[model samples]
Target: MSRDITAVFRPDPSSPNNNTFTNITPNSGYCQPIPANCNESGRRFSSFRLPIIFRSTAAIQAGHVDPRQGAMYQVPASWRAVQVANARTGETATLEIRWAGMGSQYNLYTSAVELVGGGVTPHVAHQRLWGGSEWINAPAPCRDGRLGHFNNTIYTFFWHTSAEGTCAKRASYQIPDLYFPFLDFGYELRTPDPLMMSSGQYTGSLTYTVGPGQDVDMGDVLLPNDSAITLHFNLDVDHTLKVDVPPGGNRVELAPQEGWQAWLNSGQKPTRLFRDQRFHISASSRFKMALECQAISGDTCAIFDAGTGHAVSVDVSVSLPNGITDPAGQPVSRRRLLRDGSGTELFQAGSFVDRGMGTLHFEVGRERLAEMLDNGGNRYTGNVTVIWDSEV
Candidate 1:
C-alpha cells in the first residue's frame, strides 16, 4: 500500500492596518513611492499576508503478514515517509494525505478512527507511518543490490559479485532529523516514533516431492547464532527433497570438534561432511555428521530418487567468518560452489557420498605461521558452513 500526506496551514489574522496607536497613514505616507517601494500591498509583507505552508513529514511503519497458507509469497515490503514543517504560526493546521497503489487505503483522522474503531490504524496520530505494496521501480539504496527496510531504516543485503562483501547479508538504516517548525507553537511533536510495522511475511514454507520415497534421512539442523550452512548428504539415489528453514528458527553454526588437530593426518584424505569455515581443513575444526534419518523406509526402499528424474543442479551457498587464509597464503573467503546432482566427479560413485564440494585439506604442521611481519598472524577463529539447494 502507498500513500501521500499533504499538510496545509493558513495564517489566521494577517493584517497590520488601522494605525490608531502609531503615527502611520493608511497606505500613503508610510514610505517613499509606495509602488516604487517594491514592497506595496502583496509585496509589502507578502510573507505575513501569505497563508502558512506545510510539507507533509510522514513515514510508514512496517506491518507484517503471515504467509503459511498462501501461494503468493510476500517479500519484505518497503515504503517512504516525508514530513513538511509547519509554515504557519499555529498548531491547528490540517494536512491532506493521499496514497495510490495495490490494496491501498487510508484514514483521515487516524487517531480518532483507530481509538474508536480498533483497526490497523495506529492508536496515535504520530504512529501513522507509510508502508509499501508494490515492488517495482522502488528506490535503489545499494551499489549493486535491491534495497530493503527494517526498523524504519533503509538497507541493502542482496548479493553482488563486485561488492566488497561476502555471501552474508548486512543492513543499515538512516536516522532522521528531529527539531522542526512545530516548536513555534506551544505544542510540538515531542515523541516522534521510530518503530516500523513488520509488513514482511515472517513465516513461509517450501515444498518438494520425492518420487516413491527413497530413504529420507535428512532433517533440519538448529545452529546456535549463525544463519547459513551446507549439509553433506550421502545419497544412494537421486531423490527430490525440500528443506525448509523457518526465519525464526535457530541459526546454524558449525563448530570444530575438540582435539581436532590430533586426528587430522597428512595422507588421510579425511573428508568431513561439515567444516568450521571455507578455509583449509587445518585452519578450522571439523564435526561428525549427525543426520536424523533411518537407513530404510517402510516402503522397503533403500534408495531414493525424484522418481527416475534426471539429477539437476540446485543452487546453494556457504558462509564463513573473515580472516581465513588459503594454503597458498591467499585470503580465504566464502562463496557459492555450484554443482550438478548425483555426479560422481563431485561425489564418490558407488559410495553414494558426494565429495564434489572442493576439499580444503590443511598442510599446517603444528606451528602457526605469521601472515605479516608484525605480531604473529591472527589465529583462525569463527565458523563456516556449506550450502546447497535441496528438494523440499
Candidate 2:
C-alpha cells in the first residue's frame, strides 16, 4: 500500500509571511507538529498510517531493533529522492523525503488478555531508548504483558545524522509471537523553491522495501505483510500576481524638468523631458514584461503630433521593488522596455512582495526635444501599453 502526502503553499496573512509550504496532512493519529523542531529546522512534516504490518512467526530477542537497547522501528530513517512533474506543463522538480518520526495504533497482541495491564511503566520504557524528545512517543509493554493495555505504542524519532536513529525498549518477559498490525509514520519533505515553480499540482512516488537489511529494516525477527510500501506525493502551489495603479496614474504627462517656464520666458533650451509614473505591485511568482506601443519607433514608442505630422520616440523603462530582480539576480532599476521583451523576460521575486512600489519611466532625449519644441502649439500623444505576463 502507498501512503499519500499533500502539501500546499500560498501567501499567508500570518507572521513570518513567507512562501513556505504548509503540511496539510494530519498525523497518522500518532505524531503531531512540535513548535520547537519545526521552527528551528525550516522543514515541513506530515504523517500517514501505512497498511503494512509486521508479524512475527518466531519470537524476537529484545535488542534487534536497536543494537544497544530493545528498540522497534517502522521506517528506514534515511533520505530518499523522487522527481515530481507537473502534468500540464511538463515541468519537473526534485523532491527529497525521509522518515522523520513514526508511531502506530499498534496491535502488539499479548498471548492472553489477562496479562494486559501491569507491565513496565511508560517512564521506565521511555528510558530504554534514545527518545522522548520528538513529536510523540508511547512506550511498548515490556515486563508484564498487561503493560500493553496501558501504552501499547512503539514510537521513535529519526535524525538526519549518518549514525541513524531508533527508539528504545527491552522485555524482561515473553510477548508471544509479537505482532504489529499497522505502521504509522511521519515524513519530512524537501521541495524546490515555490516561487520559481509554476503554479500547479506536482506528483511522484517512492516505494521502500521493508524487511531484513532493506530500506525499512525490522531485522530478522519481524516480517512485514507488504514487502514494499509506496508513498505518493502531491504538491500544490497557489501563487498571486497582481498590479494596481492609482486614479490619476493612467494619463502620463511628460515635460522637461522644472516645466517650460524657462523656455517660455527667456527662450532657454531644455536638455531633456521625462516623467516618472508610480504604481503598486504584489507578486509571488516569476514574470516577464513587454510593451505594445500605438506609435512604434525603431527601439521604443513614439508620440505623434496630430497637426504637424511629426513623431518623436519616447524611451520607456521600469524600476521594480528591491526584492524583485532580473534573471541575473540584480535589482531592476530603469531597465529599458522593448517590444522584443529582451532583458526583462525573467523577473523573480525574493519573497512575497505585497503592494510594493515600482515605477515606469518615460523620457525624451535632447535630440528629440528640439522637434517637439519647434512646434509651439502642437501636442504629442500616443498610447503605450505595458504588459506583465506570468507565462514565463
Candidate 3:
C-alpha cells in the first residue's frame, strides 16, 4: 500500500513560541548543508531548493495464499521514486533514498530492500548516470554515507551536492544516479506505561518497537531530496491516552472522562507489516506538559524544602499519580518547593507589574502545586524583563 509522508517542525501545533519549521525557503539560514557528491563534479554544492516528488501510491500483490494461514504473499517490489524539482532550473532532480522501509529482527522475506546507483561503494570514482559521464568524487563525510540495499529488493542512495554556498542548482535532473523505488514498508508497535500521579495528573510513557523499519538519524537538519522512510504500527489494544496536568495549572487535558475506549482490543496485539516503504515515524506523548516561567530576580538557584517551612532540608520522595514514596517505599512527607520567590509575583499579581516594586513568590507545599510539578516541569521560569528597576 502507498501512502504520503510529510515533515514535522520543532515548535509544533500547540505553542507559537519558536517556529524553526515554518517559512523555510532557499538560503533561509536554516537549510541543511550541501551534500558531499562523490562523483566527478570535484566541487561542493548544497541542494537546498529541491521540491518533494512522491508517487501517488504503492501497489501490493499476492499469489495463491491461504486466507486462514495469514501470511503475506510475495510481490514484485520496486522503488517508488520521488524527485525534488529544482525551482531555479525547472529540472526534476533525482533524490537519493536514505532510510529504506523500517527493519525487523526477523529474517522473513528478506525485508524487501535494495540500493542501485553509481559510486555506491567506497574509494570508487563517481559515475554520473543521469546527464553525462560527469566524474564526481565519493562523498567527503563518508562514514555512514553510501548506497545501501536492504533485503536486496529496496534500492536507496544518499549524496551531497557540491556548490560554493547553500543553494539549489538551476537545472532539473541535476544529480546523476537518482532512481528510488515507489515504496518500502511500514509497521509500528507501541507499548504504553501509564504513569499515574497522586495529584490528579494524567500521564503515561509509550515504548515503541518498530520492526523491519529504517533508522533515520542524521544531524538536526534533513538533507534535500532525502528519500522518505516508513514503518507499520499495530496496537495490541487501545487504552485511554491522556496528558497530565500541573496540579491546578490550566493546560489542555487529554483524559477520556466518559466513553474513551481504545481502537485495539486486549487479546489482539498490534503487528507491523513491512512493504514497499519510504516513510518516518515520530512518536511523542500528547499527555506530557511543559512549564514556562521567568526569573524575576537574578538568583538562578534551586532550593529544596521538606513539607517543613525550614530554610532548607535534605529528603527524597518519589511521587506517583496516586501517592508519594520514600526510598524504602514508604509514604514521604509532603512539602512546597520554591526556586526564587521573586518570580511568582507576576502570576499572583493577576496583572502587569511595573519595573521596580512588584515581587513574585512561588510555593510548592500545597497538594495542587506539587501535582503540577509532577507532570514534568513543563512550566519553567522565564525572564521577561532584561533591565529591572530593583533587585529581589
Candidate 2 residue runs with Cα over 4 Å from true position: 13-17, 32-44, 59-74, 105-176, 375-377
Candidate 3, residues 1-392, lDDT tens digits: the string is 21222222332224322212221112211113322332223422222222322221212112213221111111111222334332333433222222211111111122221112333432121221211211121222222223333332223333332211111111112221222222222211112221111111121121222111212221111121344323221111111222222343332222222222331344322121111111111111112111223322223322222342222111111112212122343432222112332322211111111111111222223343333334433433222221211111
Per residue, candidate 2 scores C-alpha lDDT tens digits across 1-392 of: 77777889887535224766776766653344443433215654555667777776675453344432233553555677899899998989887887765554333454223223345555344333223221133332211111122243442332222225443345544445656666656567777778888888999989888777677766566677888888788989888789998898989998889898998899999999899999999888899998999999986789988887789999999999988999889999999999899878889988888888999999999988987787653789999999998878
Candidate 2 or 1, higher lDDT: 2
- lDDT scores for all predictions? 0.20, 0.69, 0.22
Model 1 ranges with Cα > 4 A deviation: 1-184, 190-192, 195-392
Q: Estimate, for each residue in 228-277, the C-alpha lDDT of model 1 and write its tens digit.
A: 11111110111211123345322333223443353355332222212222
TM-score of 3: 0.18
**lDDT ranking of the models:** 2, 3, 1
Worst 10 residues of 2 by lDDT: 140-149
Ranking, TM-score, top scorer first: 2, 3, 1
Q: Give the TM-score of candidate 2.
A: 0.78
- Comparing 1 with 3 on lDDT, the higher-scoring candidate is 3
